[model samples]
Target: MKRLVITLMLIFSSIIFSQSNYEILPIKQHLNDIYIIRMLEGENIGLYSIIDSKGNLLTQTDNILISVQKNHIYLVTKDYKEGLMTTDGKWIAKIGEYNFKEKYSNMYKEAENNSEKEFFIVYINEMPRHKYGYINYKGELQIPIIYDEAENFSEGLAAVKLNNKWGYIDTEGNVKIGFNFDEAYDFKNDLALVRIDDTSFYIDKNGQKKLMKSLFREGKEKIENLGYHIGSAFEGKLKIKEKTN
Candidate 1:
C-alpha cells in the first residue's frame, strides 16, 4: 500500500512538471534588446511575453497578436479589440477596449514619419452608424469616436468629417480648420483643396482661401498645352514647353 501511494505521488509530480514546461518561440525582436516571446504549454498557452536579450521577463500578455512599432507595442485581443503597451510590460492601454484597425495609406505613412508623436485612427463599425476617432501611442483616447469619417494625420493635422462637413484637427484634437467645407482633401504644400457647394478651391493652413487666378492660368495653360482638360485645377499638371535652339 505504501509503495502504491508513492508511485501515485511520483506520477502526479511528473505530470505537473511536464505541463509546466513550456516551449518558447521567438516571434519578434525589437531594438536588439527586447524579444516577443510566445509561450506554448501549460495554462498560459497561446499567451505572449516580452523578455530582454539576457532572458529577463519584461511583460506577459494574453493578447492574440503583439506587434512592435518603433518604441510602442500594439496589442490585439482575441475578440478583435486593439490597444497599446510599453516594452517594459507596462499597460499604456489595456487590450479589448476599442475597435481599432490599421489605416494602411498616406495616413499611416504620415503617422510613421512623425515618430515623435504617436497617433492612430480608431474605427467603430456598427449597424447604421460608423464612426472614427484618434488615439495616441500611449493608448490614450486623444480624439473621441464621434466623427463620421477621419483621415490620418498629414502635416500635423488630420482631416475629419462631421455632419457631412469636412475640416482639419491638430494632434491635440483642436479644430485647426473649422467645419465649413462640403468636402476637403489632405494638406499638401501647406495648402488643402476644399469644396464649397460645387466650387473647389485651395486654402492655406490658416483656413484662408488662396487666389485661384494663378492656379486657373496654370491649369488653362496645361490644358491647352496637353490638349486634355485635367478635371480640377489642383488635378491639372503644368506642362513646360522645352525651349528650341
Candidate 2:
C-alpha cells in the first residue's frame, strides 16, 4: 500500500510539470514580417508573445490579449478594453486606456488613411452613467467622454447625443452642428437627415437645411404634403416615410 501511494504521487507530479510547460503556436503573421504567438501553459493560458518565423521571442505579454487587425495588433484586457500595438509588440496605445472592443466581423476593415488619422470610439463606465469618447491610434483623446451616446464616424463627422439632443462633431471634437435636433443620422454624400419637433429634413455638412426634392417638403408643408412625416435617413436617402392609410 505504501508503494502504491508513492507511485500515485509521482504520476501527479509529472502531470503538473507537463501542464506547466509552455506551448507556443503561431497565431497571426503581420505585414511587417513579425508573427504573433499564442502561449499556453497551466498559469498563462491566454498569454501572447511576439516572435519571428524562426521562433525567436521578441516580446511576451501575459496580461493583454492580442488581436490582429489589418497591419496592427490590438491589445485587449480582461475587462474588454482595448489598445493598439505594433507587430513587434511595441505599444501604439497602452491597454485598457481606450474602451474600444474589437468586433470579430469588422476586425480586418481598413483602418488608417494617408489623409486622416485613424480614430476609435471608447466607452467609459462611470457607474450609473456611461459615456463615450474618441481616441486616435496614438492614444490621444480627440474627443472627451462627455457624450451620453455617440455613433461611429461617417463623412468626417459623428453624431453625438447629450441632454437628449443629437448633434454632430468633427474628428477634432468641434461641434459642427448644433445640439438642437431630437434625432440625427450619419452623414453620407455630404448630407444627413435631422429631426426637430417631429419634422425631418436633410442638412448639409455646414448644418444648413436642404430642401428635399422628393415628394416630401420641409416643416409643416412636409407633414401636410405626405400626410405623415419622414422618420430617418438611410444610405444617403431618407426612406423612413410614415405609413399612411
Candidate 3:
C-alpha cells in the first residue's frame, strides 16, 4: 500500500508539471503571425507573453492581451488603463491618454471590418473639461477634440454637442445636421429622438421632424388634465401668481 501511494503521488506531480510549463496556446483567428504563450509555474505565472510565428518573444508580458482583428493588439497597462500595441512591441496609442478600460472591446465590435474610414470614439477625463473625438485603429486623431460631448458612430453619422446644443456630424467631421436641439440621441431605423423647449419628438436623418412617438406623451397628458405645480422645490423653480379678489 505504501508503494502504491508513492507511485500515485509521483504521477500527480508529473501531471501538474506538464500543465504548468511554457505551453503555446492556439493561434488567434486573424493574428496568424503571433502566438500566445502562457507561463503557469514560473515567476510570470498567470501572465501571457506574445511570440512571433518563429517562437520569438515579442512582448515581455501582459496581464491580459486581446487580439482585435487586423493585427491590432489590445493590452492593459500596469495602472489598469488600456492601449493598442503592435505585435512587434510598439505602442500605437500611449497608455493613460484615454480611459478605455471597458470600452475598448465595444469600439471594435461596432467597427466595420477592415474599413479604412473606421473611427472609434476617444475622450479625456482630465481637468478643464472632458472632450470627445474620433481616432483610427493606428491611433491617428481624425477629428479634433473640440466637442463638449460626442456619441459613437451610427449609420455613418454621430450625434455631437457643441456650444451646449446637439447636432449630427458625419465621419469626416462635417456637420451633416445643423445644431438646433437641446438634446439629441443616436439614430436607429433612420430616425433619432430630439428635444427642444422641453418638448421631445423624433426626427429623420435629414433633420426633418417626424410625427411619431412623442417623448413626453404621458407628461403632456398629465399636464393637460390636472395642470402642473410650481414654486415648490420638488415641483420646479418657476413661480405662479395666485389669483386675488
Residue runs of model 3 more than 4 Å from their true location after superposition: 1-22, 26-30, 41-44, 65-73, 85-97, 101-117, 212-245
- Alpha-carbon runs more than 4 Å astray in model 2: 1-29, 52-60, 63-65, 79-81, 105-117, 213-245
lDDT of each: 0.70, 0.68, 0.69
> Residue 10 error for model 3, in Å?
31
Q: Write the per-residue lDDT of candidate 1 for residues 126-221, one digit (tens) a residue.
A: 658789998887678899898998888889888999989999999888999999999888888898888899677788899998887437855876
Predicted structure 2, TM vs. truth: 0.64
Error of 1 at 167 (Å): 0.8
Tens-place lDDT digits, model 3, residues 71-175: 466666444666666555555676566654224442225323543335667777747777888877677887878788888788978999998999999988999
**Backbone-clash count (model 2):** 0
Residue 40 of model 3, lDDT score: 69
Q: Judged by lDDT against the true structure, how good is candidate 3? A: 0.69
lDDT ranking, high to low:
1, 3, 2
Residue-wise C-alpha lDDT for candidate 2, range 1-245, written one tens digit per residue: 99999999999997676434545444534436566555565455666656655545555445355556655566654455566776555666776665663443232343343133377777888878778888776667889998988888898999999989999999999999999899999998998888999678888989998875312544557466555333233422533344331
Q: What would you estimate as the lDDT of candidate 1?
A: 0.70
Error of 2 at 85 (Å): 1.9
Candidate 1 lDDT at 123 equals 72
